[model samples]
Target: MVNTKYARVLDHPESSIRWDQESPLTMTVETREGEIETRYGRFVGGPADGVEVVEIDTGVMRVVVLPTRGMSIWKIESKGIRFGFDSPIAGPIHPSLVPIDDPSGLGFLEGFDELVVRCGLESNGAPEHDEHGNLVYPVHGRIANLPADALSIEYDEASGRLELIGEVMEARWFAKRLRLKSRLRVRAGSYRVYLLDDVTNELSKPATMQLLYHINIGSPVLDDGAVLEAPIEELAPRDELSAGEIDEWNQFGAPQDNYVERVYFTKLCVDDSNETTTMVRSGDGSCGLAVTHNVNHLPYFILWKNTAAKSDGYVVGMEPATNFPNKRSFETEQDRLVTIEPGETKSFRLSLLPLINEQAVNKTSERIKSLSETFEATVHRQPKAGWSDMS
Candidate 1:
C-alpha cells in the first residue's frame, strides 16, 4: 500500500513564500485507477492577476480551487464538459479589485465568477441598511472575498483520496471573529467532489452567522429543455415576477434577450439519512449535474434562474443553504439565523456529482423520483408569507 503524503502550500502568518506562475509547485501520485496530480500556481495578468490557484486532476475530473478567494471553486471539467458559467466579468477577479464595500452594496458582483462560492460567516443575503440609511452589511457578506490564511494538500495513495484544505478567518476588533475551515475532497477516477466546512466562533462572545453555497451552472447543461429535479416539500416564488411563471420554475428555455431573473425558495424532503439531492439535467436527460447535502444542516434551498442572453450570463443556481438569502434582519426575525457561543463550531457537508453519461443521469433522476413519492410537495403560486422580504 502506498503511504499518505501532505504538503503545505501557504501559511500567511508564518511563511512568506510568494507564489507565481513562473515556477509552480507540482505533485503527482500513482493510484490503482490512475494518476492524481496537483499544481499550485498564481495567475499572471488581467483581472485575475496575482490570484493563487490549486488545480487537482483526479483522473476523471479536473477542479480548480482558488486559495486567494476563500477557497471557492473556479471551475470543474468532467468528460470534456465544463461546469461553470461565462460571466460577463472576466474573472476570477482578484479580491483586491473587488470593491465589496461600495455604497450600492452590489460590489460583490464585480468578482462573482465561480462555479461554487461561499456567501457568509456573518451574513449571506441582500445588503441591509440601518435606520440611519448607513450600509450595515454589504451584499452576500464578505466571506467570499477573504483569502485563506493557510492551505494544505493531503493525499492518501492507499485509498486514492485527495483533499485540499484551507482556513479563512473573518475577524476584526469589536466585530465578529469567525473562522471557516474548508476541505474539498475527491477520489481517483471519481466524478463526485465533496466539500466539508466548519465555521467556528473564535471570540469570547456569542456570534450569529449565516452561510449559503452558491452553486452555479450554465451553457451545455443549462440550455433549453433542461429541468431541475428535487424532492421538494414546499416551494414558493420569491416575487411577483417569479410567481407569474411558477409553473416553469423547474424548466429552462433557450436564452432570450432582455430576460428577467426569477428565484424560487424551497424546503426539500430528506431521505432516511436526512440527506437530499437536487439535480439539473440536460434537455434529453442524457447528462447533468447533481448536488447532495444533508437537510439537517441545510434545511432550505434556492433556485435562481437567469436565462438571459449568453453574453449576459445565462445561468442557473442550485443553492442549498442554512436559510433563505434574505436580509440578515429578516432572517433573524424568522429565527433562521444560526448562533454559536465562544469556542463553538458548526459543520456542513455537500457533494457535487457530474453525470457524464445518459445512464448516470437516468439513475439520479429515478432516485429523486423515488424520494418524491415519500412526501407530498406544496407549491405556492405566490411568495409565501414569512419566506420572502416582499411578503
Candidate 2:
C-alpha cells in the first residue's frame, strides 16, 4: 500500500513530522519532506497525476485538506488527541463550489463554523448581476460585492493560534464589501470573526448584510449527561407563522436525551458573566461543550436537526443564526419573505467553547437546573386537584 516509506517515520520521527495514515492503500504523509516517497490514491475523475492528501498536524489541530469532485476541502482534527475527526471545517476560496449537496435549493456547507462568501447577487436562477457588474437591485446605482476568501491563514507554532482572513462576498443594494478577519485560538479554545464594513463606494450605504455561524456538535457531546443552559426568555421565531409545531417549547430548557428543534428571539440578558451557554455531555460530566453568541446582532437563534429516519441522528445541528430561516423579505409563489431595503446589513459573532470536565460543568449545570425548575413551576405546574389525590 502507501505505507512502505511511511513505516519508518511512523515508528520513529526525527522531530515532529505532521502526518497522515489511511487504509485500503494504507498511505502515510508527513510534513517534513524526506524521500517524498509514496503511492497515491485515485481522486475520482481527477487527472492521471493524482493529488496529495495533506494532513496538517500542528499540535493543537490536525487539519486534513483533500481535493474532491464536490469541493476542494480541508478537514480539521485536533492534534495529540484524535477524538475530533468526525467534523469538517469546509473551505471555499472565492469562486468556490464544494461539498455540493445539491448545487440548487437551500443547501450549505456540511461541517464548518465558518464560510467566506464572495461576489455574486443572483442565486437559484435569480437575476443578481448584469452583463457588466451593475446591480439590478441597486441602492444608489451601486452593487455590493463579496471579497475573495482566504486573504491568508497563519498557524503559530508556539501558541497554536490560527489567524484566518476571509474577504467579503457581495450583497444586494448598497452595503459594504470588506474583508472578514478572525482568529481560531486552540489554547484559548475560541474563535471570533469581526464584521468588516469598510468598502469603498458603499461607505455611504452604511454596510449591511446577514451573517450566521452554523455549527454541528457531535454529541456524545449530547448523551443523557448533557444539559442545556442559556440566558433566554420568551424565545420566539423570527418567522412566528412558520415556526408552527417546532415553536411549541421555545422557552424551555431542552434535554440532551430527547430530540428537538426550534428558534428563540430571547430576552435573556448576557452580561459578561453570562457570556457562556454550556452543554454537559457525559453521565458523570467529565466533558462538555459551550457556545457564546454576539447577542447584540443575532438576537434571533435557530436550533434545528433533521434526525428522523431520513437523516442520521448521531449529531445535532445547532445553528445560531443572525436572522430567520429565510431572510425577512423573500417572497415566493408559496409565501412572501421579508426583505431589507437598499443600504442595509446585519452581522453576528459567536464562540464554540469546550468545557472538558466535571468541574467545568458543575456551576453551569446548577444554573440550568435552577432555570428549568423555575420555568416548569411557572409554565407546567401540577393541577391542585392531582395533588389532592395524594391527600
The prediction achieving the highest TM-score against the true structure is: 1
Tens digits of lDDT, candidate 1, 351-380: 999887899999998888888896789999
lDDT of 2 by residue, 1-391 (tens): 4332231111112212222343321222232321111222332221211323333233333333222211112233332211221322212221123222232321233323221221112221122334575433321111112223443344444443443333333443543343333333232233222222222223443333343344444434544434345545444443333145333432222233444443333334355443325342445566555556555655544444322221333344344534433422231321321133333433335555445556766756665455444442222122122111111
- Give candidates' CA RMSD values in order: 5.6, 12.0
Off by over 4 Å in 2: 1-104, 109-162, 171-178, 188-204, 224-226, 237-267, 272-276, 280-284, 309-313, 330-348, 363-391
lDDT, candidate 1, at 292:
96
Candidate 2: worst-modelled 10 consecutive residues by lDDT: 382-391
Off by over 4 Å in 1: 1-25
lDDT of each: 0.87, 0.33
